[model samples]
Target: MEFSSSLTLLNSKTPFLLEKRILLLEAILEHGSISKAAKAVPMSYKSAWDAINSINNLCDNTVVLRETGGIGGGGASITEYGKNLIQSYTILQKEHTKFLEKLTTLTDFNSGNLKSLQRFTMQISARNQILAKIEAINIDKVNANIVLKTKSNQRLVSSISKNSIENLVLEKNKEVLAIFKSNNVMISTNNVKGFSARNKIKGLINKLTFSEVSCEVNILINDTDVITSVITTEAAKELELKIGQEVYAIIKSSDIMIGN
Candidate 1:
């Protein structure tokens, strides 16, 4: 998705004045040494020093004060101007985030294209916040399937289309965020064991039906609870599902949707 106007500073030509670099400077000031600041960001010592050098070159006055060998040993500290710069940058960053969020909300409200609107929406899922990537869609007269891969290699199957996928310019290895609510995931332990998934409900197999026409198998997760229907009977038997055995019901938090 395209960046909002408020995020222009992050995409500017001046590479040295980036927010991350500014943050690195602030972190170094806070930690009193480049090595400590690098550790704080989980970055290499060389990378931290490079960022500091870049920031120093960008500004007229020196932002950091480095004290050499003494009783206390070498340490770094921020100059008065450095502290002021951090304060100003923090304020601007907050304002920019707010402005972009508002713009995103307004765009969602007015857009008729639901998929397009969803692309711009920021959602939190599974304790991690991410954006949605609508990729590789295939449409048919009966149903449509969209293949969506997330930043973290998580795959999602949704009903969308090939034309829509092309329009979005979805390509292999492209960086795209995937947004889903925590409830949307359908969990099953067909092959996996000892997984730490939270919402597993145990159930029994009530009926097993197989045919050459179309294989359908029904499994009961609970006595009065929801039943899971699998398309293939081979897959059902492979799961070791029997009439009196126990199976789990796996549902992600994002899958549960409430609407009129």
Candidate 2:
């Protein structure tokens, strides 16, 4: 069998860049019009526009610029930042090809050892994974405080070791995955002022499940995102949490883990 691979760049767990999307951007750069670019890529104009918007939303910098009221109505142009991305992706694709080639040579197809390599893939057990962008980073002698903003415009603070910042290459405007256990999330009915925890996001309870002692609370923070919290059944009953009820999800800064 022939071996081939496709390269993709991700922001947190979301796919930020793909081969077809890159082709769309390249076509836009060449044609200087979104409509023309869409035709060149064999994609619908709406698809092209949606792809651009998705990239812009995930990226720290705007990659495409739309111009209007020109000789030919309006046209779209790729920014310098977008051009740089194209170049970087090209380099990464070459490296990815080389890596696949080396791996193919080292593998024995009949040996069935590929199953062992599957175990090397990383899996996180954390129930809560929120996509966020690093807004700011403050460092002390021991720890670094990272300010993150979610797509819903909710701000979260994460305190991690200074060494972790260097290891993860964390910086301002970088997209990261904020992970924490569901048990670490505390649900409160009232918006407690001056709480010790750094994060207190107000959301509506959309789902609730209760067992003998534990209860699972799923709070809808935004139209597309939800936060899950595990609390004692007694506490949940005392708080009288129900579907459609608004509440706050509290979490400690130290409990939050940032992952790329």
Candidate 3:
């Protein structure tokens, strides 16, 4: 059987490798210099340098080093740490292949359903995703109230229709993730009062990025978790938002999506 899948070595928040970068690293080891390695991997010298810089930034230790003025001037080689990472990735690749082989041997495997599932498994365009667990779910005749406790112990409230409660099988103590677009989150520098939105998470402004019309504001909660909101550029300037300023992320419960 022939199938294709990708293996990624990720740090807690960032990807550690793409296969091409790993191939370039492997070429560095075999060819003994960045210039030669670039030619071996058929990559431009500038692209190879950029990959090296990215690799160094991702790791705690310097993974690749440039040597100079020792009979041979200015060449590059992988560090011991980098070599270890390569070996680890090679082992992971073999394990991935074996796992795929085992899957093909299963008798009741449904490829059609798996393919359909893969479509939804793709990364959504939403900018904010918060991992949470259901603390409580309140139900009335028409509406359902859902309470979510995030990993950082921050609380969020969501309201959905009774039909959604039944269809999604809402329950207490269930692990789920909340997804919402940046524009769905409203930002306020002052205390929000008499608002229709159910979720109001207070956080410190970590960063603010501007576009032509809008700006993306990143807020850090409890020094751990982060949520982002998109607000108009004019609003941002009016609020006089700066790094470390306190702000609130307001989200309507109906706007939040619950993913199992």
Query: Relative to the true structure, how large is the alpha-carbon lDDT of every model?
Result: 0.55, 0.88, 0.84
| Model 2 error, position 213 (Å) | 0.8
lDDT tens digits by residue: candidate 2, 134-162:
99999998899999999888999999999
In terms of TM-score, the best-performing candidate is 2
Candidate 3 structure quality by residue, lDDT tens digits, 1-260? 44568788777867888888888889999988888888888888889888999999988898899775343334888999999989988999889988877777762344344544554665889887777889999888898878999987888887778888778877888766787898999988877899988888899999999989998899999988899888999999999999999998899988888866
Ranking by TM-score: 2, 3, 1
The segments of candidate 2 whose C-alpha lies over 4 angstroms from its true place after superposition are 1-122
Winner by TM-score between candidate 3 and candidate 1: 3
TM-score of each: 0.40, 0.55, 0.53
Q: Model 3's lDDT to the true fold?
A: 0.84
Which lDDT value does model 1 have at 189?
A: 45
Backbone clashes counted, model 2:
0
Of 2 and 3, which scores higher on TM-score?
A: 2
10 residues in a row with least lDDT, candidate 2:
111-120
